[model samples]
Target: MKFDYQWVKDPECFEINREKAHSDHSYYASSQEMLMDESSFKHSLNGVWKFHYAKNYKETIRDFEQKDYDCKDWDNIKVPGHIQMQGYDKPMYVNQMYPWSGREGIKPGEIPEHFNPVGSYVKYFSVPEKMKDQKLYICFHGVETAFALWLNGEFVGYSEDSFTPSTFFLSPYLEEGENKLAVQVFKYSSGSWLEDQDFWRFSGIFRDVELYSIPSTHIKDLFVKTVMEEPFDEANIEIELKVKGKIEHCVIQSELLDPDGTEVLKHEFKITEKNPLLSIPVESPLLWSAEYPHLYTLILTVLHKGEVKEIIYQRVGFRKFEMKDGLMCTNGERIVFNGVNRHEFSAKSGRAITKEEILEDILIIKQNNMNAVRTSHYPNNSYFYKLCDEYGLYVIDETNLETHGTWTDFYDKDIILPDDKPEWEANLIDRANSMFQRDKNHPSVVIWSCGNESYGGKDIFMMSEFFRERDDTRLVHYEGIAWDRRYPNTSDMESQMYTPADEVEKFIQEHPEKPFILCEYAHAMGNSNGAMHKYTDLVKKYPQYQGGFIWDFADQAIYTLDRYNNEFYAYGGDFGERPSDYDFCGNGIVFADRQLTPKMQEVKYNYQSIDTTITDENITITNHYLFTNLDEFVTTIMILRNGVEIESEEMILNVMPHDSITIKNPFTPLDEQNEYCVQVVYTTMEDTLYSDSGHIVAQEEYIYPYQPVQTLSNKKIRIADDFANGVTRSTPKTVGITDKSVA
Candidate 1:
């Protein structure tokens, strides 16, 4: 049973021969057809398990499943969690350096033998009577690095690479009564080179794990590719199916149901082989857009021997995306991206976020009038892309290939270029391919990013080329080329991270050949980013200056109770570790506990896609609805007294398409002495977005007092009072605010 594995260029060792029963390629069901025969099973293998920790690989037991070995002294640990967070190892926060910093100098594909920690996990369970004679398999949704598995002293399998699902057949190794399962997870493997993402490095089985039985006849894989022609008025649909077991006669039926549950198109085909391709024509299909987001259900039924055995359903949208006249267009309209960068992180769960958290993120983005998102640094979970497709949000699916630790040093010392590392080339391509294959079918994904923070090179160029060759449905993105100009064509657009406004303007002014985007800017660190209005103002002046993604959405935090027994989500350095940056990880628009930060007030104000201008002193407003119509929403007019509302009115105004209108009668402010600020709000007449009742989509506010300015001479400052905690300085022209310093 020994298999030879290459260090870096081994694609053969990655394939598995044993087939899964009743499992579709992209979808799997453990229901009546797959596991109902084993009804006595009560629990799943997803929660807590017995755990043993080792500091390094050398300290771990290589043969933990030896017949005489005993794991009675092992401690308890939760599955689907990180070993570092469970008190087994210290939480390290170095951006680019490996965890084995002072100890090792290992190159690519070489594991650190000295300080690579290993985790040994064990689970004890008994098979119910119904599952006695059924064929069973174990599936791991995600696992860090590499690991070997054993069941009751018999070796089952070994696997590496943490992003994809891997299943192993376990029927041959199961016992009749009590069963013992063992898993050994390593901190680093040769596969770790491909997983150099920017987030904190951790090791463990971080996703779901389940075991189920499968039926004899099943569909192994299904491929769906739909192309819309003539501006989504007509569609050409193609489906390819791969099946397992015997099929004397096969029949496939497909139906397209519209949003109102009406059958739009239906077709049936006959098949006699294992794999077959079926193509059908759909007339006058409903197109999907960020504005409308009309979706159709694709129901597929596979029949064998005149009996329905498999039914797979996929929700699809008809849309065409292309680049025209130097602009990216979707469904024949120029696509303007009002987007933000999102890291798949949770305050209480780290990267293991639940469905509710993900849905909440989508609602927030949509409510703020944002239509796009960039999966910054790496690819998110599969369910995230599915939700984006359903919710009508555009996606920039990024691959998991970031060597920031290696390239961060190059930035400081002007070290020519370090991206041509021969050992890391295959890893980069493999990572890009993995992300592309897994996310290609999603209608929401519009761009394929090679990676982030890694300086551009031939390795990344290959990745860009691979994306162009594999699929023409989306464009490629790589922001690192702004650092290395040698490969200017590596990315489809001129994207940079954290560039100043003047620099961005100059870059666009100089090379107007491609569009410009700020991938990461206005670093929202602490109570910072007071200058967001400056960059957004530039968007109005330049059309090529498309919008960009905010650096992040939320801070990564963990749930913990304080000394007063108050439960608060904690972040880096909260565990009392040495050499840590405290509170630096708390730089999210939302607080560590998922509570909205005050910074979101600025975000909601600036991220509004529409702008309203009121001419004359009476404030007759004009609405710039990017997606919705003014008549569809209720407008609220408010006059504020120095940031406080003193006079307000709710009015109904019907605005025509792209036209300006004057209000019939304007209400005058009651308070004239105070600084009277005028504000206008536009909300849905009926709830259309992901909110209940009504939600505000656009707002405009004008600060009052019009501060009359007076020229002041540049004079020296005089110290009025100086103290240990507070200091006061005054200029000759006017007294300034006091500055406080903490000891």
Candidate 2:
């Protein structure tokens, strides 16, 4: 493995000497460190590094990780950043195809031989004083395509699959002080075929890198699963624990905190054997929903005899989601998801988005009446799922797999990828396992999606079955089954992309077998999303036509200086690249600058869970939420005559979910037949983790006694020969009197 790079082209050799995948759970040294809210055991390697670029493999520096190599004079590049953005290579944006389309004729599991770029990076650091004499491990959160690592002239490991965490043991290669770390990143690889998503082609290390040390007695991983029964108030919390390292007689103490920071349950476990299992019960648990997001914090304290070794914290939500009577239901009521597809992006940082930016996006999504988001095409950063769980949003977590370019040519079916090819099977299943293991504990993720747009094959079906066999708490979702019905059971529900409402209705009526949803719809490219209410309106006519996610959440635009040195947002082809799909990446309702476009107004109204209707003599308020009541919100009514406020009043109504209430309007009678308008508004009465008090939830307006005006003739004002009389007179056309303006 050290002499050659066969792992780059051989799909069967997915990873070489890499650590096994595990759950992404954080642990602290003590309860005091956990309260400080920072990791005391982890060291960050996310700063500057000496870097060198190569256009091909032949040009890369040889033996760069040798103990005597002097690399201080090399150029400095930022870690967790893409090489193209740092003035090393030109960035290329392509959709539904590989970036090397015209330059090479590539097959199923082949690589481009000529122009693939390589990046050699070197970093020098010493072990943290606290991490010495412990088991040390290095983790790379993400890297594009493929990469190899070395320390002090010894090869560590190699890995692919750019979206999940890859860790390697570093204690054996430990140097005394000022040790060298070298990483070689390849732009394209065999794994690139499975990662052909509709995004910009980028290379290098693009995510965080960390070095952490584990104590002699540590918790390796923890899985928290909640079991809810009929009536759905009580919950049975089951925990599967894995302990590692030298351990003496140990006991685990567990405690649960409610939404209001109150302890509800406590238990003690005796670790008599390996991989212990424990269960606890909570009476009348506060179930979590999008409308009322209730979360419970669980804390575990590990003690060996009389001293505390480690403490772990995790957030849990007790809600039941299932397919009940041909409709998707949460907490025993039918669910409708008002969602949008999201791509993690920024104008300045490319795919390396910041924590502040993620927080801003989540706040905007909640503010605009959206309740769900589909992590379209791939898995996002770990912080994204944590934020969703804290701020309350439903997520559809997708695996990092797509081969859309291969299937577009149906004429040559023999040339498509993963079409019963045995070599590609292991790679696909490994990608699935990596994603499921890292993200299965998130309560926001209700569905596990098999790749996207890679037409259907037996290999795709196997990926779907892997998800089903691993976890039964969540349902499976796949959209490629429409391309081939040989695997009708790939997706538990029938999902499609950009299907019309009438067609969606016809399918549900024709098949009468499964629930239906549009995985992607309402393409929101600049001033679009017209008639989007048609899809949301179908939630009433058909119980199975649940809702659809708008095409996207934000535009994928980058900032580049123009010829005049002025910065402007640039789309595809702006960098003078070949085979570009220009401006198609700007399909988000929110611009790249993090500002909302005018199209958001229509989206806000269409996706609102509450609906209000106003008339001349009556007012109607409806609660569309599946588990909330109208009494939880503050409702106010205001009336205007000719756009002037005549009367304003507050109202009280207690309408249950999926129910409506009608009351006499609080508006005065019209005396002169002026334009009378009525408005109904609903707002939150208290503050939440995501929103503030008095935030408007839903609103509607209506005008009564309105009449349509017609222009029978055109208006004319003429100034004629009066100029000769020293006093000009203007005359209005007499026939225009028939179409007089109404006051």
Candidate 3:
């Protein structure tokens, strides 16, 4: 059957002729160098492409996907970029408002017909000689709204769900010579209503595109789970593998290596079926935590007739996150998530973020004393989760679904999606499954958020159930139930957004059945975050009050050049587009240009794990970390007289985890009459993956009140000024100033 272009507008037609789903993601390698250097078997198709812009489907060139079409003379546009940022369409930002609000009246499953933007992209390339005879596939990391693919003038597939990776097998449609790859992206679709997030509206293939070939006997999917018993003395490592292609004489071998590169466990098995499960137990296993992120590597080898065909490497951490006694604990210690909501954004490229930018964000989070990050509203790039595992940051991975616009105007009516509607159930569930499968392997992910704010419904409740049924190792989070209390069990924790500190405390005290976490709090808008310490103080007072994530980490602004060629960071409404939220998108502690603002200081002080209190004669140090000790930090003391430094000393003290100690002052006061104060600074002892040596983590100061010195002036007058200058005779008188009167 010929490919139908109308499927792009149909809500039910999400995928067509796509490859069979196996696992989230996997790669192949023939040698160790190829495994480490991923560019060997994979080809990146992220350069320029011949592009065509059309206002609507009627104006688009109908035969642009044909092989005989000459697209060489067309304009060029960069892949992994937004069409709006490239001057094809205007960028519009809105919060809880659809882009086509007043321009057109559209239903749930219907899109606008007059002004929808469409981008046609064509790229030509020849298959590499190494992958000619193998099974080749094309992977699109992300695409907006909806897109259709064609190769060599033959229909390949269509896909939606822009956040997760969409992959298609291309070996069946390729030829010997140059092959033409064409993709048509629609800015508005039936899926657009389900994607009304509080950010700018952009459309394009805004992520990496790559072509890869897998070996005959390869691991299609891998899931690793680390189980720890009480007391955390030992752990059981479970490894599951799904093998495909060839399995007659293949043997699967798994090896576990500790953080110090020492092999701890090895198991070998014969591949009889498609799925194989294996387990290994180790005594006295080192646990993983945000404070001390110890990692172990698991390597999988697929052998055909005693020869290695492919190797899969995964980083694993041994930790346990669970709810005990109505409190969330990790490794038997109560975990306080000093977290922030992060958006995958870039100043130059809208949603197409690079590895360097991802690393910089993680480093900034770690340096600011934050230990957790919530992939705000959606799942970020897969590389981000892997980096979190290596760098030790807790992650709350969320699904890509938001329907805030549905409840904006008719809020009293409470009209929302997938509530009882059977048609929307499949698409909503598919989104949840896609996110779970992709990010389930990472140990850093402790919670699976159903989605942002799609309202409470049976569809969302089913998604939460799906997560719990598939994986019982982690918890689920959803803040939508706060708006609709019909399904109170939709989330494991009592989550809310922007709840005042007093109300949070009262709720926890009243109902302690479930732990409370302000999933979204401390809105970091412009000149905002006033009195943020109130919430942080509640964490210490009530055990049920777990820490919450700030609204965001960095501002969502795009770089633009003005008419006079002057460059500036532009926010909402800057592109002269209507239905915008103005500067509402500029609510980040870090500016769009990667610079830290003043609000970060308050965040740093409130999130620090180490607590220090100073008195007149002693300094008391307390360690609140779960798995780290005070010895890992260096403490320096500076003695000041009248705010001027007089003596400096580095103290050597060892405080265990969750312990407190008091030490006497090492130096006596230099001048008692003058004001004396002491400043204590604590910094890391050694370099870590996220911070360097001597990076200040926490500090405190103590001041002593003083009384100023009182002086009495004495005046002396010479009696014989000029006449008796030679004799030098003088008379002296003393003047006293009393507390009651001065003369």
Q: In terms of TM-score, which candidate is strongest?
A: 2
Ranking by TM-score: 2, 3, 1
lDDT of 3: 0.85
| Candidate 2 lDDT tens digits, 480-536 | 888788888989889999988789888988986888888899999978999998888
Instruction: Tell me which residue pairs clash in candidate 3.
Output: none
lDDT of 1 by residue, 1-743 (tens): 53232322232233333233222233223235222323232226888788888987668776666534677577988888778777887555444554554567765445677667889998877765655666687777667766777788787777766765567888888877778889888777766655555455678887777775544455565556677655466788776667666666777677888977799888988777888888878888777777767778777776777776556566777777776777677776656676778887765656666788788888877776778898977777778888888888989888776666555533443332226656556656766766776676677888899887777778788889999997776888899888887788789888888888888888888888887888887666788768887788777777678778776777766776789999987666677654344556656777655677777778777777556765336455554444456777788988765566666788777776345666642444444344556788887778665876468877876655443223455665545455554654545354322222200
**TM-score between candidate 1 and the true structure:** 0.84
RMSD over all Cα atoms, model 1: 6.3
What is each predicted model's overall lDDT from 0 to 1? 0.69, 0.85, 0.85
lDDT of 3 at 552: 91
Off by over 4 Å in 1: 3-44, 66-73, 125-136, 152-154, 171-179, 194-196, 212-217, 272-275, 410-423, 485-489, 561-571, 574-582, 617-626, 640-665, 669-672, 703-743
Residue 41's lDDT in candidate 1? 27
Look at candidate 1 and tell me the lDDT of residue 588: 74
Q: Can you list the residue pairs that collide in candidate 1?
A: 96-405, 347-557
Model 2 spans with C-alpha error above 4 angstroms? 1-3, 409-411, 668-673, 707-743
TM-score of 2: 0.95
Q: In model 3, which regions exceed 4 Å deviation? A: 20-26, 412-414, 667-675, 707-743
